[model samples]
Target: MTKQINLPFDDSGCGWYAALAPRPDVKRLQGRQQADYAVIGAGFAGLAAARRLAERLPEARILLVDAQRAGFGASGRNSGFVIDLPHKFALEHPDPAHKQRLLRLNRAAIGQLQGLVEKHRIDCQWSHAGKYQGAVGPRGQAYLDHFERLLGELGEPFRRAGREELKAVLGTGHYSDAIFTPGCYLMQPAALVTGLARSLPPNVELLEESPIRRLERDGQGGWILHGDEGSIATPTLLLGTSIFTQEFGYLRNRLLPVMTFASWTRPLTDAELARYGGQLDWGLTPADHAGTTVRMTRDRRLIIRNTYKHVPRYGRSTSDAMREQVRARHRGAFLARFPQLADVPFSHTWGGVYAISRNFTNFFGELDQGVYATACDNGVGAAWGTISGTLLADRAIGAGSEQLRDIEAVTGMPSRNPPEPFLGIGVRSRIQLAAWSSRSEL
Candidate 1:
């Protein structure tokens, strides 16, 4: 039976850290403000960009705005995996040079994340156990074979895991072939975003609940952005609005609105461990979303969702019913893979909206002279978000950023906008197909 997704905003859906933390209310902007640059969206991308901007331009007045509280958007309520899939695999860009640049940028982004975690003394439970992608049957195996060949051609550092080796790593016989890589990292995503937002350089002003009504361009190549309570006029703008930016002028047609959901398990105590294979470490794309990622929270709760999508999942909400169904499906997999935790009372689940482009690339460029955006991370990864932010800040400060220029050269994949209305039907059908296929043999 299809489950209903009602409470998409509930805390349980965001996994452990977000659930444990206090839900900070969104603070509405009251009147007026002025800054050198205005940044919208408090997610990882926006927050990180704001931080770097402060570092580069210590004296530049920065205004950060979000529709909700800091980390309340996708950044706070995500799987929080710090994995970076080279553009070659996830993106259809055939340019090996572009792929290499992506690899370097991602590597640098991960290093930046690590440095921030250490510098801030943030307790986000960071780890670098890497990640595994397994194919349980023929269909999945075919993709694995193709992926392995690509890996070989790319000369990426990777290994193929046979059935026995896969079993040893995952403690399961559910997979036939696997691909192992060392770029994936895991963390408490909400904590990381919230931690970063909390320690702004004391110069960046964060305004939450400040829904931008519209950004009116002035004659002087500046913008007058207004919120319900306040407004700001700035010569420059940084649009961190991932999915919602499309609501504006040029960005509307640029971003493809997409929704992805994740389900988290109730925390598992010690006795539960001894009863099963003691599932530790983390696994991603346990099923079809070989592109998405999955893993276990620090408290040993299973987070079964790299991301779930249909043909036309527009907007930024998830179904409560679907989230519960995901938990049930994960429970079944847990029983099959490690029977010990089947009975754990499933406590929490959550979902969020991630923006994507038709070509699976993100929007990161100076849309206008002063306005810029960095969004569309199809994968539940933070590397892109971090990279986007740094690039945005670099542009905002007039600093020379070669990485940004190189990426800008390759425009996002030609967008294939979903047909309105029926688009949902298409996405829904694809998701259902993948789910059914995961259950049955290849």
Candidate 2:
């Protein structure tokens, strides 16, 4: 069944992605169009797929359609952190083998991302300094303990830092312990997406300010996507829209798209740089119940955000509650993390919606013949999206192997059910309790 969810991009006047935009403009689609494959949504999944598909099928005609400008969706607005660490340890699992295999897959995916960005010369400010997730206080220490053990057990290359080392790296007295993982990297997300969008070979046609209003099965064994400019007919169709609102009826409940809000401070002044650190650090987020993710803009501003998870809230009509709560968290979060910069003024605050799936991971595979789908990155896309796009493209070219068919993700990488519905509520609520119980004085 097609979902009846609302598209958010039509509402929000601006998104977090506007900060470092590529500003690449493509010609709009007009009249009737036909192609070997029609890919919808120009975010990572669609663009990635389009890029690879061209490399594999040089002769095939490809068309990538987007509701807005390419890379203008969550792809441009995300924290831009290339998640290196493993997905958090699961509360329910049969054996450690599945987790181990996933770690290997994650490593391969990370390697592939690094290789692709470098080979393609993608200028998304890819850096591999790793991430320092600060664990402060007694409770915070224990929380880091669980994650550390999970990585070690899964044989992930990780190192835990004591209070002294943590202070050395973070220059903060608030944190008690920390875990550094190499699997994650920082990215200039919009730049990366825009770079890829512009790199699409001339063969792949792109459309902007166009949306698929309806999909009708044609008598000729193809799907016709009705757009404002015109209709596109293709033998194969790929749905890259992360959250299928009521508009896309195929998936109403299968995917959860959540909107996350963020505010980027103006470039840090020299005084502010010295206050935090005199280096271009990737980003630092404290380990708390409502932990906020922070990163440096190429210009150096503290980008802070944390609100809403595992559901679809993107584009135009993001809730006021999500924005207010995130702003509140940012105000108090900085004070608790660094009393040194409590007076810094925020430059901008905006929100964007990203997709999450049943497994809290991106899912890819054929839904039916001639209709292959991919999406639901949870909060982790960027690198993973690149991984997914490349894999799907290879499959289309018949070069993909079953062993590489890891897209049939575990039923619940995070939880089988909706995180908020029951599974998420259960796990996150406990995590919150533990976080609260562990803090010294919030």
Candidate 3:
């Protein structure tokens, strides 16, 4: 009797999703269906899990369900960095061996995704252009210094750049110093996700725009996922629902969902691009945890992602006023970096939610006899989510691998959070404090 209380929905203003061609007809679940395996999300993790299941159990029927079209949710709305190294937040891991293990997992994810992109010939603007970790002001510089030291300790290859060097390529002197790592890849997130969904194996059936409304035990050792128009009964289920996993009566207050906003400018004209004077395709992540993420797309658009809000009510949509305020903040960030393109108008703006835990560890194991979950991507959703989902499938099939063992060794339960009003107050206060401390980077 696990009822889904809040339905997840995204606004129609994601720049990445809008830039792509129109989607084909979506097939919603129509009747009571049965499958050997059922996956509850179509994002990176769910897609990977479904695909792995199909590959591992070719004779088995698999069903992949999503509340929205593939890539239209957080997957499509992300900053699009398939990160290989540990993120700024991940630096908190006290054990160097643990960090190294996570790095190997992240790189393995990149390899898997790269193979898929090549096999499917995904039209997404995939590039090995790497990434720039930039810092602003004193606090940000200190963070970058520590990050650089950690990179060296990990024996990773990176080049340090000062203000002038960064300005020559980024066309902005806003950054005081930066580190460039060549191990990351950048792409159009929505395109990559849509391609992956469409290219799933023959044994896997994908149903979009099908929101599961309720969950019931099937008397036997199975589960039933009830949707508005149909239902799915399966012996096995994997929840890659991210923050929405709470609605399924698991994780509850243990997870924290934070909404982040991003806005992308309309394609820059040839003259405008020349005036901006930066590499046509590059990505920058802020050194400070709360700073902005900026990107220049191959399609000649500029994207700035910043601002965070704690929106516990997933059923309620963000108000027009709040979105506008976020857009305004994005505009200011854009102008600060590229004042030369002052007149460039943003094509679309939207918000996406990413979940985190108090201890920064992801949930990656079974919750019940027949139910499994892999959520809380922290900040490296593209890589971490993919590896987690793939490994979860392996573990589900009772197959053992060194990779799975490493993930299990590092993955731990999230620290328990306080209840209700106290939890909300604490999370909001932390967000505000971080925002204030990293104001310069923002």
TM-score of each: 0.88, 0.86, 0.98
Q: How many angstroms is residue 136 displaced in model 2 relative to the true structure, after the best TM-score fit?
A: 2.2
Q: Tens digits of per-residue lDDT for model 2 on 249-280?
A: 65445565556667766677888878876356
Worst 10 residues of 2 by lDDT: 410-419
* Residue-level error in angstroms, candidate 3, position 390: 0.7
Off by over 4 Å in 1: 1-12, 23-28, 87-92, 290-293, 310-319, 413-419, 436-442
lDDT of 1 by residue, 48-162 (tens): 7888888888898888888767766678777666766674335345877777777767777899989989999877778887777777778777777777777776787788788
Worst 10 residues of 3 by lDDT: 311-320
Q: What is the lDDT of candidate 1?
A: 0.68
Top TM-score: which candidate number? 3
Least well predicted 10-residue stretch by lDDT in candidate 1: 1-10
Better of 1 and 3 by lDDT: 3
- Comparing 1 with 2 on lDDT, the higher-scoring candidate is 1
